[model samples]
Target chain A: MIVHSASIEAINKDIHPGMVVADATATLPALKVYNYKEGVCEKLLAELADWAFRFTPVIAVEAPDRLLMDISGCPHLWGGEEQYLADVVAKLKQRGYHANAAIADTIGAAWAAVCYGRPGQIIPPGGQQTALSSWPPAALRLSPLILDRMHRLGFYKIGSFINMPGTVLRRRFGQQLLTRIGQALGTMPEQLTSVLPAVIFQERLPCLEPIRTRTGIDIALKTLLEALSKRLLKESKGLRKAIFKGYRLDGNIQQIDIGTNRPVRNVAHLLQLFSQKIETIRPALGIELFILEAPVVEDLSAQQESLWTALGDSDANTELSNLLDRIAGKVGSAAIRRYLPAEHYWPERSMKISHSISEKPDTLWRVDRPRPICLLEQPEKIEVTVPVPDYPPMLFIYKGLIHKVKKQTGLNVLNANGGWISKRRSGITTALKTNRVRGIGYSGRVNMTKETLNGIYMDFLHDSYEAV
Target chain B: MGQATEIQENVVERLRQEILAMQGLRVPLENELRDTGLGIINNAFPNQTFPVAATHEFISDNAQNGAASSGFMAALLRILMCKGSCLWVSTRCRIFPPALKAFGISPDQMIFIDARTSKDALWIIEEGLKCQTLAAVVGEVQELGFTESRRLQLAVETSRVTGLIHRYGSLPTNVTCVSRWRITPVASIGEPTIPGVGFPGWNVELLKIRNGKPGRWQVAWNPDGFKVVQQPKVIEHLPARKTG
Candidate 1:
């Protein structure tokens, strides 16, 4: 293809001149020369489809960098037909590529003209050969092997190749050579398939006057949300998350992105979520135009009605979640936490913070086992003066106060695995051992057995404890 | 032995059934007491109607005995139970459970949370009022600022949950609360004609109510529980003789 050859020349400076480069051009026959087989013709076709919409919708990509446009009516707007072609070439050059443009009635004629015709030649409806007479045989985009064979057959150029016997050409270079010759002459009607354009969803809100204050920005955000919500509804879609871009006249842009727990179109709910997050958007020299674009959207499908669904009663879960959101917004989120049940029945380790979303599965609260309503933040170390082993201590010293045990209750059971380990006592076994060592006497070790952990009691001997 | 186990199981089953049967029996007793003005309507609110929107405050001195704190809660709860449920976020276990039950507040209707310190207690009470389900929220806390009290007042105005703040110990005089009620325990009477002998009696004084007259009233909280009675209008009274 001419694009391959043109791109090769364009990238020659960057490529080492003497390197033995494999001509991947054959592997991707229609790929641009500079692309070096990295991109397929299909992907290039899509890119061209998106880019060439500026010129005309009737454009279709011919193999390689070639584009065929039925610009039968839409050319004079960009100055004139010749100027428009020049404008397209200039734009392509600006996008880091050199391109050649030509216009013709049939796609084959246009392809041949751009690849082989003289510079700035507009081939008439029926003039294909006369238009391509002076072009080289390689301009037909035929295999180099076939072109070399044509040269050997005394056909140095396409004009001379056309005069050669058609049977001789097919017999020598196979049928593909004769087809390419016919295609260049506009006799074969070479098909140029078009690609569908990608769907793009975007909504823009231009502020009537430049918004600078917090109130002004909030008002503008409401307007942007309304426009975006309407567009999403019309498209039968809802956004999972949206990006609010504040484009300032000074060229700096600030983007504030907010995500919702569920698909939502309710303006008030969305406003409340964003009101907590809009502070993250640094106004940045004040915004003039606001654009809300949703990159993540899905079809709005109805949930299957369930026979067991509660219809009239209000959903308590939603009310709880909204209450949590409000509390988290006012007081820091760290201050609010919902109690979650743990597998083990230990009092201290039985609860953890639940996630903000309500969809997460939770463990059921168990009522049979008695859990202490008040858990001492730290299990204070007590010095037992009573005889150890099987008996509960009659008196123990805690915080320097000797409290006598009024009652001795024991819950005897085997120590289970995965029990609650309080954070303060990281090495619990060692801490328990240390308590035994520091206890009343050397005989205290006998009382520190795991079997004796059922219950220990103490009462205050005196009100002698002072603030530490 | 097997028959004894079966009998015990039957007894447990019968008790559960009895409890269920008695759930609706309180309506008549409450009505009769309401007619006599001796139930929660009389004991808690002598004003005849329930204290709905306005804030009721109790400021305690914690003097001679810790009566002001406990008595204020007992009286306040009695009034709150007249309307329905009352929420008590207890800082210290300063609330006497038996006293509140004597005032006709079923233990089930009153929810109690024993927090470690006074600060944690107010936080729970504040959070409870925001729920708007409680008829009255009572907290026995040491201190509450003007701004914090205003926040509670505002939440109560919107939710209609009566805010009853009972200060635990004595606070400085300048400290402002919505309304203040001081409670003190006097000697108990033996009988209708007899002098004084039995359990501790409570002297309920409405030191402050937003739109109502503040006055001291005599009430005997004997072993038979609290009973409102007429007493001579005097600032100080003679100590009743102890009867053996």
Candidate 2:
């Protein structure tokens, strides 16, 4: 591959950019090579702009390693403009970067001086013409084709065309060439778009010394929480999730996080949530700094504390979500569940466990059919004694207890007492209809067939009918 | 002597009233939340009304007893659930939500918290009991000690939410629950000479109650609520006297 960039050491060896890497390595067998990506230069320039924020609040990043800072009145903070420029360049060099900076009356002049004139040069107002005349025509930031055409026309440097009339130069080399010169000489104004960070919800507490005790950490967390909640309360917003981080003196970060089902800004409740997880953090050496970040926030319209605190049905729902949140934090969210009705015939599939506490059921729970309050997880097999043909069981054995069946459906028979005693088919049963129970018993042996018995037989959840 | 005996009776009556008051057993009004469909059984309570925000225990001998207690608890929870939800915390719950509809309680209004361990279930139950937002908390555990039951009582006292504990064993006399009950499924009798298992009926026995009398009642389930079934009037027929 061809060379993309060359260091000062490589340039001193006459290894200019655009030369093949094979030729350069042949010249110096000890040369090191690395691959270059497209956006590396822009990324580095943006980071440099961020670092330069200490110098000026208004800083803009230009592509391909350029930064524009509006230092009109900011230089006095650092002694003077020259020292400021030296300090900036020196700092960049100390970080292993070769940097050139210039201060001029206009942005275009400053850019041209940094690119073409001597390094660390400061130009007086209206002196860009004298300083830039000796540099090449390309220093005006013109296209390569325009520079090639100017070179072919015997114009090698800015001084060659410095005294030419603008109209004549525009006609010969096009308007772009004259426009660049005018912009550099301060004949035109320019706009600089500054980058400023947006406000974030974060609070920090830097301790005077390393804090090693649990009380110290607790105090730090409380202070940060108070500040954060105050700001959130003022903004009519609340935090749904938050993280607390401690910067330990041993260079380790101890972090704990908490989440809420609903938006909450109450410091007391949030502190209680953190208290459940506070013991998990080991403060080892000591904590030097603490930071709390609200990663998730939501809008909760403000209401008076007394109004919400008053007992009401709506407030009960709110308090319930908070209570569930606290319980979930202790035993995980999976341990808690709400149920909704599912339109299924099987009892197991008739209801489903719901994760959301406030979800509405699609199908109504069937009240027409009777269902058992406590269904056996597994079907239980018991012993039954059928007294006669086409008749309900007379006695059943469940859990080794002889529970004599009291109700008989059809074919009424007398017990030893002979009082027209019928083993009552479970009357008012959750599984049977009232009329069906009456019809089977009062109709007198007409519907006592095997098929009808199986219908009542299938309702195992109703009672100990499985024994029958 | 008669006058002295009258004075002693007056003092004893006053002492009883004082004890009832200290137990927080003031009689509730007729139109309040004390209507638990218990009929005459409600009078057996200390205040002649069903207690709310108090701990009740149900002891079961086996699976049949367990099911009966669950049904009875669900019936009570139905009355307590007034636009509020109930938490059924247990190791593994087998109650069918759709079946709760028969008790006049919509299944969607109930939350089931299944814990992997009985201890976790107890913790969840205590937490739910302490939350004033819930209507009631039903905990089905294998066992609970005297101190644990006392802790649960304290939680309900502050939150004013009822707590129901179900266990498959003998009752604990030293527990701090306000009342203890045992329910057994009784054979159902059809209405008006119709034969079959009519409404699901149970033999509800209040074994012990604080500052109240223990009694037994036969209750049957209806879509509306509990119906107290009267004892059957069985007239004895004279055995034939002509054996000689």
Candidate 3:
């Protein structure tokens, strides 16, 4: 058995990581051991990275217990670089974690400083050379083979290579050693990638006391909405969708989402939309944090009030949109629909509902022909007696009602060759020939069977029939 | 004294005769009707114009008749929806959106609501009527109670938006609507010289009209507008019928 890691006490007893467990057991017969679970360390590192986000938005997690933070402009918020570094390390230590942190001018330098320098070290800007001069070359995070080769060459300290010419080092150790040295000394640039948060218009509030009451949630929501709306107003933008999330003390997250038909920046209106569903969030064990996120935002121009208070140029449109928003909030977004005409001859295909009301129909409605006021979704089959070929039915029975042929006109035969005809045998032809033939006349081929004719008739019956 | 009283009575009688003649002249002005653009049907209404800010109900007995009524409503809406949007509440809307274009109403100007039930549709209609932003509210309902319609009328009275209710398979009962029209599709006027179908025609019956005469007119929708067609004196039978 090999020791994967060692605690401070174990290390104090001269036990170290990667040492043979049997040998350590021989050295200290009563050593306690634990079985390591796979992926637990990485999971903890990820979690630590998430927690570290509270300090700075820019942070990257290095695998196997290492984190890099670009505390460039963040330290001043904590009163200075020294206090900020000390505070982070102290907080982590209080949480029972043995942490080592170092601040430097560069990522490579900071990484080396944290592993080799003092536990809590702050290397001033442009001081990477002096700070890392005494550290071992292994602190540069070089490969084990390179470290062994350097050790054999009697170049133990980074200062030994700091004076070596770049070309010579490149010839002896290749590009990696030169790159590492250059990066540590701040000569070469390195990219530090941080985790990108999904929501940019998100605000979080950590309560001093756990909030469990409905009023508390409402207050938090109002505060968050005010802050968010202020930010939105400054950006000349508005949010259409908002999600309110509550982090309970027990670690469960409860969330509710509200959507608006139009971009909204009014704090009161947004609060009202959320107020309807805010009670649904159950704060079991009390909520510790409130997060409000605007996932969908759009540009919103400031509304100019009408001076006369009468119907102004845009007042009617604005009022209509506001009313629609209110109704949508109550019934749902799908309840409201706006339709536009399509360039199709078929009734159902003739008009299409638009996603938004602002879209205008490209084509005007064709008024050259008379259309039925109501078109059946499907044509109903009817029994008809045609007095003569190519003439409208004299009598028809539809839904068990018999009607004598009335004065008939406007008869147009719909040929089967029309490409727009539905493939489904909906019996529209027969139904139209019998019931709707008087106004907008239709006749099916006499050679077709009753079954196929029924199908075709049904199809036509379902089609939008023009009223004569 | 008797002679003086007789002279006074003769002067009073002359003044009364003059006033009655002036009233007779004013009758033509008061009886002037508002032309509904459709010249054939203007004489049926009191002022010869469709009632504005009033509720009108259109009943259809069958699907074909329902289609005809829908067309009539669309035609009316084209004139009513001048600048504002309209709300259409229905359980199942069968009127083809493109068909509205035939009546000059754009599909984009209409906002449709698919209510889950007839009751919900009525509620939505009432709410829509209460909103002044909408120019009109159209509901295709199977049932509309007298009280429900009265409430709707009150809403429209305040908002001034026209309410057009297209009720299918509904029982004909007395309601407080300004007008109740039943439209049935009839034979369209045929163009014998052009060898094709003419404009759509409807047998429009004003079943119940408030302060208006109830009459039936054979009206055809033309590109220009609705035209009152004279009854054909002779019936012609053709051997071949053109199918659309």
Q: Which model scores highest in lDDT?
A: 2
When 1 and 3 are scored with DockQ, the better candidate is 3
Worst 10 residues of 1 chain B by lDDT: B23-32
TM-score of structure candidate 2: 0.58
lDDT of 1 by residue, B112-185 (tens): 55555666666666666665445577776777776667666666656666677767465734223434566565
Task: Mark the regions of model 1 whose C-alpha exceeds 4 Å error after superposition.
Answer: A1-203, A206-209, A231-245, A249-264, A276-284, A291-312, A315-320, A332-334, A356-364, A368-370, A412-468, B1-42, B45-143, B162-244
**Candidate 1, residue A12: how far the Cα is off, in Å:** 48
**Candidate 3 global lDDT:** 0.71
User: Model 3: per-residue lDDT, tens digit, B99-191?
Assistant: 566667777788988777888788788878887878788999998888998888888777767799989897876566777888876655656
Which regions of candidate 2 fall more than 4 Å away from where they truly are? A1-201, A304-306, A344-346, A360-362, A375-468, B1-14, B23-33, B169-173, B191-198, B230-244
Instruction: Note the clash tally of each candidate.
Output: 4, 18, 39
lDDT (Cα, 0-100) at B169 in candidate 2: 64
Which residue ranges in model 3 land beyond 4 Å of their true spot? A1-199, A203-224, A244-256, A268-292, A303-313, A343-350, A363-373, A379-468, B1-48, B173-175, B191-194, B230-244
Docking class of 2: acceptable
Clashing pairs in 1: A403-A458, A403-A459, A403-A460, A404-A459
